[model samples]
Target: MIVAAVDAQNLVDALGLGSIYALMAVGIGLVFGVLRLINFAYGQLIMAGAFTLAYASRANWSTWESIVACFAVVIGLSLVMDLAVFRPLRTQSPATMLVATFAVSFLLQSIALLTVLKVQGQLGMPASTVARLSQAVTIWGVDVRKVTIVSIVAALVALGALALLLGKTTVGLQMRAAATDFTTARLLGISANRVIGFAVLLSGLIAAVVAVLLTARTPYVQSDFALHDMIYVLVGVVVGGIDRLWTATLGGFAIGFASGVIYGALPTDKTAYLPSVLFALVIVVLLVRPAGLFAPRGTSTVERV
Candidate 1:
């Protein structure tokens, strides 16, 4: 039997899978790039959206409505996470921020676990999210789900809009400023707090989209899914390098495609070997280009907004 072969369907799957991975990766990278601390709770943002979608489905809300509402809710959750977990810990150290995020992640996961099924003698969540995808589109006569199409489109549109927002808007200007040198930007009278808050908000929003799309692909939201999948996203960030937003995005897709292809050919028992594959990829890239594959975070030449 042939071990490896290229096909159109394979290409589509890789791209669709890669785009979502990129979406997850860039958001994770954003938190790390600025704060230089891992947001372990990052995946919780996705889980929050999944749970929101699950509940909204019970109301028979349209998919579009549910998605939009989930995004908004998660963004609000991020603001709260920032205020509650991150802000006070700012003066401690990067490790403290990491620990705080991990705590948030665990707490959120516990909430999901305890609510995965109907709570007896209590309110039962009537969520109808068992299936979120319907039809499959054919590319050269190969089947791919419509949700995959929606994911690709939504990711492109959302990410493109964000690119323009960061590149063109005044608030975006401040964000780019804070990312470069938080202390120096603060000296320029730019409210680093606000800028960082905006970044966290963006992270929540992006993670929500990623979560919903991935949830659509799953049978149900499991407590361990977000924490486990998050490592893959973080792998993209590390391999891709987090100096710039685009780097994280591109790196994410590349990592996704690479992982998908490799996983496709591997036996179930061998699946656990992928991380080392990705880690080696990252190590090689860092060795060759420490700043990352894309350009480093741009310097804040413009005055703070």
Candidate 2:
């Protein structure tokens, strides 16, 4: 009975962790699906959303008000990337474009790191959120936060909206045609440029959602990501297969479970190994199935607007 209860608790935490990873992976996958670039700067996007909210809150803006501003800034940022980097890169070779995206990601990271450094002397988590995370409810013997519930809910809603946008809308249809074959999408008069713009916009929106949920759950945003969380996110998507959104989602849960189990079993001193294991898993999965677990089945993702 004790073991069963422990398993149940592990599962709950895993679900929470999975949802967070899924949130990040959704935007990352979407961007790659359309643009074929693995952007390392995605974390900076999350950081931007948090810092934007943090700044707004400090300026006496209401929380929701800050959220609105966050989306606006992220969208503007996306538009800028589209207009500048991606547009210019499109004319270059694939390897060149890939390098350009990496460069852009690095630039964003540098800016984000410096911006946060200037605003806050030390980088860890914000002092404000720790107190906010104190309250929680126990369900199924699991002590879960309202923030986690909210995060999972937001992820589901965002994903549903993405499905509608991709499957039901005319723009989504055009995006589909474009993803499979860009030249044909352009030849068919689908306005590939517009579709690409929308994809970037979508990525920004997803990033925003992830930012909000993650911040809420962490009760604060940390400027430094200690590689483990980063690797965990990568593992979830690669093992689940970026092409299969649901599989990626499921992989997030799987990873979360593995993480919880490992963390629970490990000595506190060696806990850092968790992320390295995740990284190894990701590498192994990449070696075995670079396309991902869901891609072999040819499953396409449909998220609502």
Question: Each model's TM-score, in the order given?
Answer: 0.84, 0.84
Give lDDT per model, in order: 0.74, 0.68
Give the per-residue lDDT digits (tens) of candidate 1, residues 1-305.
Answer: 11465466666766777878888886876776567667878888887788787777867888788878888888988899989988888878777777788889889887877776554223233335536474587766888887678778977987888889888999888777777787887899988687878788888878888877777766355566666668777767655666567877888888887776666556678878867777788788767766566646543222211
Best by TM-score: 1
Which residues of candidate 1, in runs, are more than 4 Å off?
Answer: 1-3, 58-61, 117-134, 267-273, 283-291, 294-305
Output the TM-score of candidate 2: 0.84
RMSD (Å) per prediction: 4.6, 4.4
In model 1, state the lDDT of residue 297: 50
